[model samples]
Target: MTAALAVRNLGRDHGGGQAPALDGLNLDVPAGSCLALVGPSGSGKTTALRLVAGLEVPDRGDVLLDGRSVVALPPERRGVSMVFQRPLLFPHLDVLDNVAFSARVAGASRRAARAAAAPFLDLVQMGGYTTRRPGQLSGGQEQRVALARALAARPRVLLLDEAFTGLDVALREDMHELLHQLRAVLEPTVVLVTHDHAEAAALADSVAVLSGGRLLQHGDAGRIYTRPASVTVSRLLGGRNEVPGVVVGGEHRSALGRLRLPTDVAVPDGPAVLLVRQEAVVVTGPDAPGADAAGTVLAVRAAGARRALTVEVVSPGGAAVQVHAETSPGQVFTRGERVGLRLPSSAVSAVPPEDAGTEEPEIADRRTADAGRMPRTHRVASPAVPDAGVRPDAPGAPRRRNHHGDHGT
Candidate 1:
């Protein structure tokens, strides 16, 4: 299958004491499928969209639409339409006229443009508000109208840059449903840029994760979420319980105790990082049999349907590890109480350690360049594992025990 859109070796530089906005970024969007560009602020999500839209020229590489290069083509010439974070509607035009404007620009008569835009307005569920002006409509309603307008151009590719960022949770969900329904009917290739993982998971068939203008990983959303290519990608996708450990033989040894490696995961025998999902760590009574390790509860916070606990576990060598776990609402545990924790081998995977010498400096440079462009609050911070102080093994310290009975040599 040929790609509907292709970005090959894309590079962009802002210059003037700033690092490149995008460097060596590449991605592909299959025809009639949705691909989401997700990452922290200043990760070049918007820059990638703009390069494909012809709003900005790339310093290197090319943007291709259906195997044809469009890097030098103007935005109007490319068969692409972009929706920004805010609705860029014409103030003087009513919702109907705004939706019809694109058709009219393409030389359709006023009557013909309105006729062409009517079905799209209905597609977005904005048919009833056709006579309202942009100022009179709510944010969600305006966005709906903006979407209808974009469709009026009959674009082969639709680009959305944080298009739903301003709406409330309920409205954002409604828009997601609308987009899904519209995609079923129109089947246009879509590229969405968002910081919300839920939005990406809900709308995208595939996700491309970026960090510091570089593509970290790109694959099916389910695979990316469950088996991220690196610790950085795992963190971006909300894999929170990262433990520093080492791989010996075919098992992993960490503060949580030794765990057997699954056959599918292949990692070199050396220093590694174990990525564990919060739901995978089972917390039980301290005396529970078959427990992997024992830890003291440091904090418990109520999440929506479950509660999150911060547990501090100690290794035999006195190294301290802090991990997060989630439990049901019915289960209650207090701080300072001892609890038994189990790290299931099935839910754990190992990846090579992050090479700080190369990636960190580029990330810092991108952050500096994006300081003024994006609000500080909008930037997604790199995930950090809370550290528990390392101390000498006290008298009667808990002995190392492998509940799985798979201790590594």
Candidate 2:
């Protein structure tokens, strides 16, 4: 049966540095639900998964399944199964034997084990290839076999560590659909570790964003994307349009201009950031329907259905800033073209920069020439974000439609 999984105060250190692989990670995955632990490299995503799978021991905290601690249990005894990035199928064994390995270990007869494996193989669409070895299978086919084998064990909790990363986009989409099928029929609690926010959003019921080995934000995909706790979480979720500003008198005054705070967002008068998705930033002709912030188009790149444009704007309080906007591909916007940008109050989020010092937080760059690189990693995990600055449940800001498909969260 599916079971609730709770990770309480989980901590881990691999030595050689102050930054632990995972630090004080607290998470809960309801029965038959999925939670994606999304983060950049070295952000403790896999380490947390290992700790949960009994492959690695935690330095502190407890792992509870259905309100019972299983710290002392072995991996085989924990009633958990993990699928790694690679299939890791036994090279010598045929698909049938590979899937029946778990049942064989349980002292079942070969026929009984194969009988138990057939349904899972059919579940992952590998039933026809029962006699084929791992070497004969394609990357996607091997992953299907691996998944079937994992399911053959009938674990209560399933952990996937970037299992679909190696597949092409189309194959990944196929695997995603297969996972949905598996979850619906098997009903196992799932924890997915991924670096792609879009993957997390598409698969998981909830997302727990991690950075520097710390829990930055955790909630439904829409809420986490729209209302990130800090600049760090925003960057992780591909929030490129960040305006440095301060909130005083219930309004955010920044280079983008003054914006009245949404009712769901409550922060004291202090340094803050105005985060508007590129899709939310409406771009119009310079003179038509003037907006709060006006800018000149610095560059434009056509990306099929949508065009990504970088606009340069300057205000008295701030230096020239590049605001990225996504527009229809059919619209022709050239460099040096004057444009007006309207950041709808209902579509923007006001969050703390969390930078008390002069140095601005390293924002993730997803636009312009030097775009798509991950931010620099911290030597140690960042401290937990304070509750006062976090407004996780902000229903006031309407969820913006994502035009980027799998490219966005």
Candidate 3:
């Protein structure tokens, strides 16, 4: 099947000695499927979305829609619709008028536009709020209308730029469910840009990871989370237990202990990194016979349904490895208690070091010492929409600008 959208060698350079916002980027979104772009700020997620939306032309490469080149097409003529972080609804228009705005722009009469938009508003659970103006609606309500507006346009492709950001957890989850239900009904090709990994995993069939203006890896959510291509990707996907180790035969020798490598992982006999999910580290008393490693509990904290334990284990070579383990709520352990850790071999995978000589013993020792106080996750303020490196009045295209920076991905 042909891809609904194809970005081929897309590149964009923001002049004045700044790095290229996007470099040699390429991606394909299969027809009727949702693909998410996730990465850190200034990683070119918005730049890529703008290029596909025809809001910014790429400095190099072409965009294809339905197997046809759309490089010369304008955003309005490309059969695409984009929803920004803010609703961007017209203040003068009520929810119904705002949703019908797209249909009206496409040449439908006002009566016909409202009639066409009714189903979409209802589709997003905003039928009762049709008469309410944007100012009268809550943030979530306004966003629902925004989605209704985008869908009412009858777009063949829908682009969502962190459309769910800034909402409370409960509302955000509601929107996710709404998005999935709408996708099943409308079947439009979707490309979502998000900084939230959980949102991407929940909404997209596949995810493409970007960093430093480059594509690192692209695969299904499960594969991307479990078998990331690099340490950067692993960390971005929330892999907190990264242990530097060496491949010995088919097993990996790490500071935690020796673990059998997954049969599918093909790494040469050399230094590598072992990624273990925090949930996989089973904790038991020191006397547990099958424990592969033993550690002293530095701290234990209750986190909702699970208990989290910080452990410091010494390898046979005397190198220290700090690991975090989660156990059932019923199990309790005190600080300074000895515990045995079972690092399941099946839950471990080997990846090459991000750089040569970056996994030395000294580095591991330092990390082990510092791991106790590190935050569970790191977060940065989302970046603003990056400049496309193209002038607003570049020939036939009129200048358009969004001040909010890119919201998510």
Q: Each candidate's TM vs. the true structure? A: 0.83, 0.84, 0.86
Kindly list the per-residue Cα lDDT of model 1 for residues 137-201, writing each as its tens digit: 99999889888888777788898878888789899999999999989998999999888887998
Preferred candidate (TM-score higher): 2 or 3:
3
lDDT of 3 at 96: 90
Instruction: List lDDT for all candidates, in order.
Output: 0.78, 0.76, 0.78
Candidate 3 lDDT score at position 328: 65
RMSD for each model, in Å, please?
Answer: 15.8, 10.8, 5.0
Residue lDDT tens for model 3, 301-321 = 776688888899997788998
Candidate 3 lDDT: 0.78
Look at candidate 2 and give me any clashing residue pairs.
Answer: none
Relative to the true structure, candidate 1 has a C-alpha RMSD (angstroms) of 15.8
Q: On a 0 to 1 TM-score scale, where does candidate 3 land against the true structure?
A: 0.86
Candidate 2 deviates by what RMSD? 10.8
